[model samples]
Target: MEHLQPSLTIDFAQLSEAGRKDENQDTVGARFPEGPALATKGVAIAIADGVSSSSAARQASQTAVTAILTDYYATPDTWRTGQSASRVIHSINRYLWSQSQNNVRQEGYLTTLSLLVLKGDKLFTFHVGDSRIYRLRAGQLEQLTRDHNQRIDKNTTYLSRALGADLSLEIDMESLETERGDIYLLSTDGLHDFIDHRTLTEKLQSSSDLEALTHQLHQLALANGSQDNISVQIARVDDIGTPSESDAITVLSRLPFAPLLKTGQTLDGLTVEKILHESERSQVYLVKTVDGTPLVMKTPSVNYEDDAAYIERFVRESWIGSRLANRHVVRVVEPPQTRTCLYYLTEYIAGPTLTQVINERAPLPVSDAVELAEQLVMGIRALHRKDTLHQDLKPDNVVVGAQGICLVDFGSCWVAGIEEMASPIAADKILGTLNYSAPEYRYGGPTGQRSDQFSLAVLMYEMLTGKHPFGEAYGKAMSLPQFQKIKYRSALQFNPLVPVWMDRALEKALSIQPGQRYEVLSEWLQDLKRPNPNWLTNRHKPIMERHPEKVWKGLAFAGWAVAAGLLVFIATR
Candidate 1:
């Protein structure tokens, strides 16, 4: 019941001054969150220096610093640090650029920004313009950012890259290993230009107090006659915290795996009503709390008790499921009592799996199939929005009930944020069902949202026609050549009710190459809902190709009539 403690900790301090300038155009800020956020998002420190020539330089600098500190935390915890920071920075750039363009005087809003995030055992840096980030460790000082200014002369230089400088912005990003005693310094050109790296490194090494060090750096820059606004920020890593994998294992291994349960068996105050499902990796039991509320309890199989990677994944499945809240996704819930073993609970759904529905109702009505597809897409989009991919999207993983289609089973889910962390265990490259997996998984090609799209398309094909788009050969095809030899069969071949546009959409989504698939899931869903303008030509195809079964049936009837007439004529003669 204890919260995940903050594993990453740091000593941080910052200062900004106008120096000789009339107004301070430099801004600095930092956020050291407590508890899970600190462990997930880490500590954020940022410094921004406004362009002296711009009319709104002060506002630009303040906005840049404030936005990074605030918006970075607002991003999904499942997003990689670079992904979250880049998206926030890009949005800030757009806002500043649009504001400048709307001004009557055509004045610009521009600033140089440097952000340093201490996450886990790593440091991530994002930089633009002349602002710099330096790391001091073991008496060695290294500049981690390159100035974006172009030198025109000895004393004159122009910034080639800065926030709001143009419609598009290019920023530098880098990641490096961090040690407990590592000291990082972020400063604007006002400070770095006046003070040399040797002086900065010496000061950082000599000082133990980061607060006093920041002020010392600022005053030193001012004494050096910095003509512009000066700002300085420092962070000394107190702890890189436990490595992610180790922390994960420690938390996941706290309790032994729950023993197999049967009806009327109780553990952690939840009594098992029945065995719901069992597999090589886990067991799912329908359980009830003392209040009689039904829930699904998933426990790892004893076979995997010694498997560190499997145990980590099993724990993370519960972690991931608890975070995702969507009508079409099964909800993982906290147990009424503190868990005494390695198992998680979810709200029980009284419905059959999609596999059962398909088996009982093959060739479902077109409208019914489309409706399920729409709900499935919603659930898949929810996962994608969190930077998580439902790599194993299949009928067996989906449950259809009165509430709608709910996606279950996250053992194969891939999270971008988690993937960024270093792990001692190698992840399984192929986790999804091969029959429903995208071709990229087999070919060692890149996979992303599009990969999920391919899996969803296969599910859709099965729902509508009770068949795979590429037939049974698809599940067995492992090589590019084998896949290339397989052709997509029309859904209408089995289900005459499928519209041509819908079939075309399925074909595109099921493309052997990931690039050929829909760029987004919504586009494919739109095509499935209505006739695509581009596919209107499909309706004009010859009847033989469009309705081959009907054509063959008609030919058979005509031949039978002719044969009957010839027989009667020969008998009469």
Candidate 2:
């Protein structure tokens, strides 16, 4: 009772005659320890109903809840707010299902559940069986989680995707945005079937006393004829207040793991010479080895040892990038699996950002801009040939050195066909910049080479014209008319000097419908070879450094040393 008191925000009033066939099942249905580690904005709740036909349901429910909470808290840092909580729950479901199947007596021993995980302003809810999730916002009640019971002709009693009943599950992922004053309630069907949303909302609306409110809600569920076990996990969003500046540890240099990693200190034979960008993830530096070869060492921020998610992404991106043998994409060396808690290494290129290059040389001559586009397109095409999608393509991600444009940061790129791909920016899922994201990606679907192409087209337009096709106005460009009518075409009206073919090429690439646009990468190739280069001019002043060939030479040498040594050893053997 005390555990429920501090964690939840509800008041249960007095109970009357409730609709239940048995007297033993009249009380609230919850299995929890008195002491639970408090979460910032999440509720660790577990619930189960004892099957009328089997005695194993009680033990099954308790074991199921305990296992779920154990794994939920044990989650690595890589499992953060953006990931699907349903995936986590579904994992639990599989465990519970397998456990229930091993014993014959517990054959039908199963409990329905609805679990809620709230971290910060993000809410992830997963429900199996008849349990539910309720949200009371703006004084209006909304039942967010749906029930699985499938009663024949009438649609009431039987259900699908419950534990111990089947092997796999089709879980519904109910994700929502939360504010400071929102109220969330998670309970079983016993509580929901009896209490209506309007009545629940009225009792749960922000009140001076929550204990009294909780008692009131409890009494009402009992009064409504609740059969089976009843339980509630109510969470009220409270302001934890902001962290002070002193709370933040400033990172301006390489993160040292042990005694010291200072300037001139060499790691893995590479001397730490200069610091690049330092942040919460890693301390990037321009490091050189004993042989006078320079490389970029991304030493993990001290935060990495504390945050598992950052480590996962850093390791994943580094490993994936290293296997790729392409000129345009920055190469990562060393096996990612061998990476320590301290740092990962990558090939360094001294060049200006495409964003900077375009800034200085906007409105490039038709021929040169086309050449840049050709390289960019071919680089992307090579990556695609390997079935990789550069989910995040922007001026920042593209490096313009002496050789050509080098795409940096495979952090958001993925193996093309995975379901849970990382987004490029902070807005929505299926990640990429808001101005460049495809309509399908913003919704919900596996974004492939085509979607990446759309982003490339946007960046191409920006590179040529020094302006975004959608610009800042596209944030509000969610309306159908804004997308279908007033986008890239208007840019042509702004600069009539842009050829009709170039304008139309950009328009076609930026098409709202993916299939309607260029169905082939060859289309981008065609655009790159087009005669009019003013579409994206390359004549801006000196944005990039004078030397790009130096980097190409270094990479070439690194490759030969490894290859020549292999050949010599083989010949000797």
Candidate 3:
């Protein structure tokens, strides 16, 4: 069906081999909402190795695929090609986590997951355990997802991470720029054991016909005497993509930028000092205007690197930052476009990274952390009013600048652009960081302002306690998808500097379950200002961050009170 874009051909096959001692555990790929075609812009493929050790492995396999497929189809159209597929899988994570929680018989019903989503040929992949995504480009196959279970020694395969075991699990997301003739082969470790990429590519060479090729590949896996549930999905790009609707929606406007006089290598009549930061994709420079006004100038990574897609994204981000014009956000100003580059000038920030500050002090003083957190919440409120979500909010991205605490790094910010950015697979990958990512992110689908709140809670938690709730358990810094349920009670006992009110407040803000987190940044800010001993932190722990009720429940209840007041006055008269 050639309506517009080039036709992308996909073929998938799954098999249960006799050597594994598992029959019903094997499952195959099909579009969710139960259909043959994926209407959503990308193709979803996965290889789930159900726990052969568990009794309910068969049912677990079915549940995992169903959850993953449902998430793929239900993805909000707002995501862009810039994010990851791990987010969609996270949506699936909650489902599997909750399902296993209820059924005791399904105890330890875990699986190794390798998920690949294809958008215009770009591959977004996430993996846990050993399932793999391999790309056959120019006769070479590159293994994209790193296996959780590394070979600790030559003889043994030790598990680092796997699905179903943890209350929540993490999946990896990385971009693979695919070409038109490129071949992508996704398989379970069962298939990888016998047929390496060279053999797989050669076997796939004869079958240009999608379904026939899938069948031949499955037969080859069986011929190698593979033991386990084996699955393979093949996709040939066939065509390249230009830009999504969101990509075109970048903000384009000229604002008050000092552009009065310029001979060359200068903007707004300033002398061109030198380039600040430039790569193949973009360039930034530290320069001064004629009067010695210092400014940081940024342009596309390079003329070629500053291709249509990258430039548009950078433009969108910079434009959003300019319009936000918030104290906590870095102010962006437009620069006169020269014949060579589309330039942007901004206030040169003077600040250290929160990460760096944390490094220097080991941990911040409690009062300072709370003071800075309040400032961040206010900044977040401003961002929400502008309908922007700072997708990659991490300690490094935030600045404890001369201006107090300012948020930076809008590079992965999520908001509607002149074009659409929310590609199906990238649903949650764009906004926020690991350890702090919302449950909705890992599970997949539309993550809006509430997702930002989840990240906010992480920051706030760090403020109240000298440590990150999730990052603390591991001796190392922290792992992505940290599963420790944050407890304010535990934190308060560990640190004497924390206030009782803050302990409860932080508990509410940093609830691992979205339902429990503060629904509105303002609500939390209000509570912060009031310093209430009886703040409803614990009572409202299980709130759906996306639950509209948090926004409207008060108004609806107030409406009822007004009506009741009128009725009582009439009755008294």
Most accurate candidate by lDDT: 1
**Tens-digit lDDT track for model 2 on 314-429?**
54566557657789888887622433335667788889988788889876665666677777777787677655777888787788888988887776665531212222212212
By summed lDDT, the worst window of 10 consecutive residues in model 3 runs over 249-258
Residue 417, candidate 2: alpha-carbon lDDT: 19
Each candidate structure's TM-score, on Cα atoms with residue i matched to residue i, is 0.85, 0.46, 0.45
The TM-score of candidate 3 is 0.45
The Cα local distance difference test for each model comes to 0.88, 0.60, 0.61
After superposition on all C-alphas, the RMSD of every candidate to the true structure, in Å, is 7.0, 19.9, 20.5
Q: Taking the tens digit of each residue's C-alpha lDDT, what string does model 3 give over 1-573? A: 011132345544444343455374655565422121232246677667776676666766677777776665543433342332455666666666666778867565667777776655455676777777778777777788887886867887766776667766766767666677777776776677888667876776666676677667667777898765666677666655443534332322122222323224655454556664445555556677666767667655444332434444565566567767678887876554442335567776767877777667645677677688788887877776655677676787678887798887666776642223123112323434565666566545347777787677666666555476655442222323443433334456557766656666666766555666777777776665556757544443455544558658877899999999999999999
Ranking by lDDT: 1, 3, 2
By TM-score, the best candidate is 1
lDDT of 1 by residue, 1-573 (tens): 112344676788888888898999899899988766776778899999999899899999999999999999999888889999999999999999998999999889999999998877778999998999999889999999999989899989899899997878887999889998898888888889999878987899987988898888888888898888888888888876665556656766789989988899999999999998898878999999999999999999999887778887887888899889999999999999987899999999899999999999988888999999999999999999999999999999999999899999899999987776545555755459988989878877888999999999988998898988997888888888888999999998998889888999999999998999999999999999998988766465888878999999999999999999999999999
Off by over 4 Å in 2: 1-52, 72-83, 151-156, 196-198, 206-208, 223-227, 240-295, 298-573
Native-referenced Cα lDDT, model 1: 0.88
Backbone clash total, candidate 1: 0
How high is the lDDT of residue 318 in model 3? 64
